[model samples]
Target: MTTTVRWHSIPELVRDAAERFGDAEAVVDGDTRLTFAELADQVRRTAGAFASAGVGPGDRVALWAPNSAEWMVAAFGLLTAGGVLVPVNTRFRDEEAHDIVVRSGAKALLVQNGFLDREFTGPPGVPVIDLKSDGRHGFLGSGDPLERKVGEDDLADIIFTSGTTGRPKGVMTTHGQTLRLYEEWCDLAQLRAGDRYLIVNPFFHIFGYKAGLVASLIRGATVLPLAVFDVDRVLELVEKERVTVLPGPPTLYHSLLEAGGGRDLSSLRVAVTGSADIPVELVRRITTELPFRHLMTGYGLTEAGTVTASRPGDPYEAVATTVGRPCEGFELRVADDGEVLVRGYGVMRGYLDDPAATAAAIDPDGWLHTGDLGELDAEGRLRIVGRKKDMFIVGGFNAYPAEIEGFLMRHPAVAQAAVIGVPDARLGQVGKAFVVPRAEVSEAELIAWAKERMAGFKVPCHVEFRTELPLNATGKVMKDRLS
Candidate 1:
């Protein structure tokens, strides 16, 4: 699914969207509703503000804020002013956020003041712009849009993903790659014009920033940004605003399923979710019970934009078991060691200012060595087995936590499950399961059930019940925390 390059830069897309979808709702944040033209107008003014603040081409600016209309304007505004966007995780503590700011060499910081009760004033001499208050008063400068020498090949954002070396590495991506990737994502995910998109995923993630906001801009969809993910609040918004598109991890849908029984969610027509192992029964329930006309699961990482995704009319079995075939412009292959490798237009240019690391990640041949383990079927569809680093050896047999977690989810009592290898004197390493159960079930019963259903080595040696598992902003279990 190679796509024709539409508008070259992010600024161009903002202008084009306004021209094409003028007077249409572009964003809905609480009582504030902005039309496409209005949003573009604010973006330009905000860009002018940034320009006045000494930001220029190639300069980096860290945006540490929660999801909101202001966050949207601030991001496009920074890009329009020719500044590289470095979105900091909202969940990060003071030190974490500041580390990215200092490492990215951000010229300025846009902090959501009073958010989470912490003031995010950057290091001395760096200006901090409060996104909420400044947008209305001092930050929204009244001037014509600044003429920035921005191009498709110019760096647009430096998103920091967790690195294997303990420090976060900034993944650099150009405007052209971002636009083209999400354009295909919109096509595969069935995001169309006039759809109201609820962006529950944090804006720091690639899926939230690119797939959520950029895809909406490409398709003229109205964005409804949620800073927080409250199941009841999400349900109310879906019913009240008639939200048509909802994309998140599998856990989001599961929460909705549990809480949205009586709620009117008929407006939700498109859903795309992935990130963790999905229970086949859950997929069946979503398709059968939910009002979504399209439900898809995909596999992607921060290093690559969306790699592969199930289509709208794919069989339930495929949708449940596999993350589907390679998306347009991406080529995928499995290595002999079971690691998934991808080469694509959507691959990041490199880690920021780290040539040695970049060379190691992307070989001379251009294949990005994905640390994930997967098996390609006869039709070239991929079924992700586990992460290469996450695989643990149980005695002599290799045990994948994701594979075991899937089997555990099949149990009727289990709502969520996570498995981590624990050292054992006898087996060398055994599985310890953490379960969030929907029904009362004893640990002995679950262990007994697992022993009958799976190989002895595969069965968990220990089970611990919990009300909820630790989830990151993207809804993936924080397995590191579990360990």
Candidate 2:
């Protein structure tokens, strides 16, 4: 007898890809290569291991590991075993990781004992699965494979927020909703069968996990997981593997430019970037220097995968300045207060076990109140102004840190910049800038230069330079950490 499966879950999709593209390369990690068929076999074996440990349907399993062949296996294994996957950020400290375990009530933690010179065992009582080693040889595989059915509405994953703002909230996502988003996401990204995708974004992030891996299987693309973001390593992989699709944040592009001298990067064809406004100069450089035939930018939040994406061959300035129009099955609207509201299949089920927070985020009508602020032009292009919380008032005039940061990026020497409001007795609040300079540039010079270009209220009154701005796993500036 067969279990009646209604929706094609992650496992089901992987199995389909294996059947359709059996001999095709599915994953490329270091010296290891896995075809779709082989990848499916490993997933089943890993699922058996989890099943042997009694991790069944609806059970919470925390995954605190980096990107690797084994990370992919464990994720599929847990989901295939009918367990809810909770991805924990590898950067999380012991206490931070412990807090998620307590909140999610994860019964099992699949953690790596050897990463960044740390060992995360978990908070006791919860069983732990250790997946640490150069290869999948150390992963679980001694038990018989388990076959289970996962419905569309079944819980797939619980991803905790980076906690840059207040406490980290767990966002719940389902298999059906996630796959639906990436079906359209794959189209926007122009991901296709046989294409090689280099995923430098951490697996813990929705961008890497769902948008990275899940999208790949949907289109039958080869997955190349980059455990960490190293410029040299990325360039080497791009050249060696002939990666066709490369998507990342603006900083990633900048880093590529820095490391991109005399490299045969002609293999790159489709380049997708977002998470922040990319500088016009940077976009020009990418278009001219890189061999990407289709370059695009998109906008979304943790609640959704990708709502808006620029079409292929969009004007360089347009692609650089604005995130493109909304994808199919999603609606975008700016609230009266300028907050961006998205309603669609991509919206998360809700915050994990946080009804109050979920209610506040997604209203009765289902419009997920994205805390971001944006404007849709007549042409339907979106320009993300800033986050609702990132907007600071100076002498009654509103100042958006993104706008200032965008302008700051124009400076040849500025590598990155973040602006935050500080208490000011006279003006109520003043803009404070945290900058990462590419070269030797003094804070006084930057402030003076900014003062000349921007209005008094918008110009950063305080400037500080650092080797790098505090960033979360997703390359977003941790503004809360700045102060």
Candidate 3:
């Protein structure tokens, strides 16, 4: 398997790809298109630009932007120059972005200032390079690439977690880990050469950067980066570009499935989705309704990259019920308390610059204590029950929102559902379901529906109907805002 081939560092991989897939279509964004060789040239020039701007090896640089062809170039260039990448979420406000830039000790900032109608001025005193400006390519150097020795083990990026809890902590990873893991991910997802991949996931996130762009690079797939998810735009792109590989959260597929009926999506053969809970019905619809030959779901986090995934030929039930067997050499086990533990090469080095928190998360035995509660079937497949912190007690009975939410989704009226524990006088805490209904449905009707389907303690005591639920950039429901 080519998965065994090691490039040592991302720069090496960039150079190797240029040689191996030189004339193949690499990246396409609207009017802009580049071959693999051209993409490599841009990466080298960008690296030289960074070197000229006083970014040295090991220096941290903040990348704040949406998904674009330029975003991929800038990221590859940053890695080529041996600068550690710090990708800020595009949804972050000025204050939120400023906090990450300052905390990560980013020496420079590459940003698209006018994106989403917000001006990202970047932090004071830091050099800000506007990636969207006409002068952006002027930063590219005319000379040969900068001579920098970036080792595989060197820190490649510091990706911050979604700050649903108190504050986001930086998850540090290396180029070696990134390259190795995603190779396996591509093999499992059936991503291959000549495939056009529509990357709608944000590049700042691991899935987009590693599983989207990096995997495309490895397999010689064409990259079509979509800045935002619009169902019509996505369908248009899939038909026009003949996009073959599309992986995203469940919401992206739901939107596509609803509107993609008359479109020419026969070119789309590979589809992978997983970030939040997925309904079995949706999985069934995707298989029966869509033209995809390969469809799967997997589980992972920023702390652990591509730990487990469903391989091609796996049943739809495995894709829906379990995250599949472990990939990328990860060893998985459930603790006595039900928390899932992962030990692998893909685990993050540690929380960047926070030893106390690192020590608390990873045990002395080299096992990462994933705070998610899960169970293993006899076949060794993992079914994520819920997050340990997200679980709530109801009248001394443990109730998982994911489990209840799954039950609620079985109802025909519920388009989307998110359950949160709300304060209750008698039960200490009870499930409060926030639902986005497909048809006319009352809160009392949903509560009654839940009552008949689940245990009395598991049933939601209250239900709130809404047109839509609050979603993060990745289409994950923001449970933090539910109350």
Best candidate according to lDDT: 1
Q: Could you tally the backbone clashes for each prediction?
A: 1, 0, 0
In model 1, state the lDDT of residue 374. Answer: 94
| Runs in model 2 lying further than 4 Å from the true structure | 1-7, 133-135
Per-residue alpha-carbon lDDT of candidate 3 for residues 1-483, written as tens digits (9 for 90 to 100) = 225657888888888889999999999999989999998988888888888888889999999999988888888888889899999999999899999999999998888877889888788998887887832366643335764778879999999999987699999999989999988888899898999999998999999999999999999999999998899999999999999999998888878866887889999898888744777777777788899888878999999988888878777688878888888578999999999999988899999889999999999998999899999998898888888988999999999988888898888888788898988999999999898887788888888888888999999998988878898997888888889
Who wins the TM-score comparison? 1
User: Once model 2 is optimally superposed onto the true structure by TM-score, how far is the C-alpha of residue 58 displaced, in angstroms?
Assistant: 1.6
**Candidate 1 lDDT by residue in tens digits, 1-483:** 357988789999999999999999999999889999999988888888888888889999999999999999889988999999999988888788888899899999988888878787787767888888786455864445774768999999999995433688899999999998888889899999999999999998998999999999999999999998999999999999999999988898889888988899999999988764776777877888789989879999888889999987788889988999998889999999999999988899999888998898899999999888999988788999888878888888999888888888889899999999999998889999999999999999999999888889989999999999998788888888786
TM-score of 3: 0.97
Give the C-alpha miss distance for residue 451 in model 3, angstroms.
2.6
Q: What are the per-residue Cα lDDT tens digits for candidate 2 across 341-454?
A: 999877988898889999999999999998988988888888899988889999999999888888888888987788899999999999998888888888788888888888
The RMSD of every model to the true structure, in order and in angstroms, is: 1.4, 3.2, 1.6
Candidates ranked by TM-score, best first? 1, 3, 2
Candidate 2 clashing pairs? none
Worst 10 residues of 1 by lDDT: 135-144
Q: List candidate 3 segments past 4 Å from native.
A: 1-3, 134-136, 140-144
